[model samples]
Target: MPKIPECDRCRFYCGSHYLVCAVLPSGPDGKECHHFAPEPNAEPQELWEPQGARYIDDELVIERVTYNGEEIIQPPQRWSREKKLWLLDNHPMFTGLCPSCGAEFERDFTARVHWDCPECGWKDDSV
Candidate 1:
């Protein structure tokens, strides 16, 4: 009959066998069976370090570094006329203007789409 290893010396025979053990039996005394499991094809944990500002060269001298240099060209900003018109027509600040009294009114832009002029009580006119 094959003898089953005693639990007192077997590292694989833990109270809970939820995790698998890769360690082989050392000897009869089981002196090295203290949760000694070999990690097979396991990758090492990577530690992250914070990165700061980087420089190309340690000792680099600038001859003429102007704040507003002519060579420092900026790209022109792109705008849509149709979108601007739509925003102007739909915006609460512009659309809430009273036609009769010509007074600017405040309205909740997020809650409601329709706005009423506070001064003249006018309901519907595109500002």
Candidate 2:
């Protein structure tokens, strides 16, 4: 009952649990079988896998990070959260009024970048 490795690639191999092959029912007698005929196509082939990946729960999972076909650039934050909150609450850019003279700025603040006050001559140096 010596099951030789040549049984998998042999032409007379009957893919079964009980039977080893058609030519030899209990497999080959020795390491090399005389009745062994090479089968071009073999069953139970190994699946091809990509590098830097592994099979997890029968699914292929990549280890490295993958991004879309676009250049990624992140600008540094100039001010802290407290400074931003202070600017939003008191600054003429967000309040639409000068902090020194209390003069009302232009209603359309979105279009304007420079928040300089014309009445009190308060220049916007924060931006």
Candidate 3:
């Protein structure tokens, strides 16, 4: 069995485990310390942890799962096929006005089969 170290009898010892003390936080390099003093109560110190950190019913709950070392999240929904088709017809990006000629529509003529201008050969990809 290993022998108890010198800091065990020191007054400033704050043994909460993982090598911690009030005066010698990381513990003394040698078995003996200059600031060694007897504890006021001189009772055996027991190791402990936070109330939430300890096991509840003999089962640990601190375990966690990750996605490639990162938390997994739900991705954003994609646009529907119908919405894409509607945007292609009415949206200005697909069809707006003739580029080669100065021919513009009064209202949105999205149902038109050919987007090419009648007066000019300007085309809008026939969208």
Top TM-score prediction, candidate number: 2
Q: Cα miss at 105, model 1 (Å)?
A: 1.7
Candidate 2 local lDDT, 1-127, one digit each (tens): 5767767778888756467789889887778899988898876433355665654544665555435865443334577789889888889877888988999998986677777889999988656
Best first by TM-score, ranked: 2, 3, 1
TM-score for candidate 2, residues paired by index: 0.38
Please give the lDDT score for candidate 3.
Answer: 0.57
- Tens-digit lDDT track of model 3 for 1-127: 1124656566777554554467667776665677778876777644344333443334433433477888654343355679778766654445565555656754556566656667776555534
Residue 28, candidate 2: alpha-carbon lDDT: 78
Best by lDDT: 2
> How much is 77 displaced in model 1, in angstroms?
28
Candidate 2's displacement at residue 96, Å, is 1.0
lDDT of 1 by residue, 14-95 (tens): 2222322333333323433445443454433222322322222232222333356544323333445786776576545566
RMSD of each: 20.7, 17.6, 18.8
Clashing pairs in 3: none
lDDT of 3 at 76: 37
Which pairs of residues have clashing backbones in candidate 2? none
